[model samples]
Target: MGETGTEEAREFAHSIGPAFVKQYYTSLAGTSLSRHDAFYGNTSSFSCNGEPSILGAQKIKEQYVKLGFKEVLVDLEGGTFDFAPSHNGGVLVVVGGSMTFAGDKTCPFTQTFFLAPD
Candidate 1:
């Protein structure tokens, strides 16, 4: 990611962190939560921190409710980067998943995001 992209990702992550963790623990039964990013143009593999589970999901939901967001969802486009606006005036997006397909085959890069709102 470029300078701008890095900054944007950091800001977005900070803004959404609370909601994510809370929601995971509260509603999804998630235990721990962590996040990472990969620039669209970067060659490194996409990465995320922490583990995911039903309890963790619930915790994430609780975090979301603590935030101002009324609703949260993972709305992404086909590209590696996507910007999603939250009900709390914040934005959630996928920073990287860019891969080029060949011979009618899809790229190996895969990323997934879930949202929870307060």
Candidate 2:
């Protein structure tokens, strides 16, 4: 583990942030939700729209699966940033974008992901 923040860590975060965003949304839109298993696990947690936080990754994935979206167009809009360096080498990514669902219905959404090197 390292201190709270460092220039080297911030640089590392910036380097990986956009690539991770691209890969994440691309996979979400084009692949089965199961393909996203690598992004979560028993220890991972998630929540959307301030709903009660789901405690584990599997359950969180289940919620997304329930949405039954066959296709979603993700537009990387404003607010994408490598906001902070967290415990160890983790990168905190903050992103805002639009998700176009079926029938051309689009919604603006922002998401934060803390990517930790495990």
Candidate 3:
């Protein structure tokens, strides 16, 4: 690609991680627990904390509801995101930070996601 086109692509790639993270976090921070379901398609799969993988959007949403976080707090400023571009125009995101479920309850976490472009 040309110089300006390359720069624009770089900037766009940088913005993708934060925007995706914001949307994902927003889904977890509200009463609408099912909002995140939009992120998953019928072919999507999810696995939590070494648990067996769950397939399909409905099942994944059900598993999340079962977790019943009710509340989720992340070390926003302290969090870090690593991104890698995929061959199919997707981005692999690795997020690391401390998470708190309630007052004085916190644990370090690292989550990975493959964000496929629409």
Q: Of the candidates shown, which would achieve the greatest lDDT relative to the real structure? A: 2
TM-score of 1: 0.23
Best to worst by TM-score, what's the order? 2, 3, 1
**Predicted candidate 2 versus true structure: per-residue lDDT over 19-85, tens digit per residue:** 8887877778864676665678788888887787787777877877765444777887664555677
Relative to the true structure, candidate 2 has a C-alpha RMSD (angstroms) of: 2.0
Q: For every model shown, what is its TM-score relative to the native structure?
A: 0.23, 0.84, 0.80
Model 2, runs deviating above 4 Å: 68-70, 77-79
lDDT of 3 at 21: 86
**Per-model CA lDDT versus the true structure:** 0.38, 0.76, 0.74
The root-mean-square deviation over C-alpha atoms between each candidate and the true structure, in angstroms, is 15.7, 2.0, 3.4
Instruction: Give one digit per residue, the lDDT tens place, for model 1 in 1-118.
Output: 1233466655665667545534432331222223212111222222334444323434443443443222323222443544554444444544443322223333333344434232
TM-score of structure candidate 2: 0.84
In model 3, which regions exceed 4 Å deviation? 1-11, 102-104
lDDT of 2: 0.76
How much does candidate 3 score in TM-score? 0.80
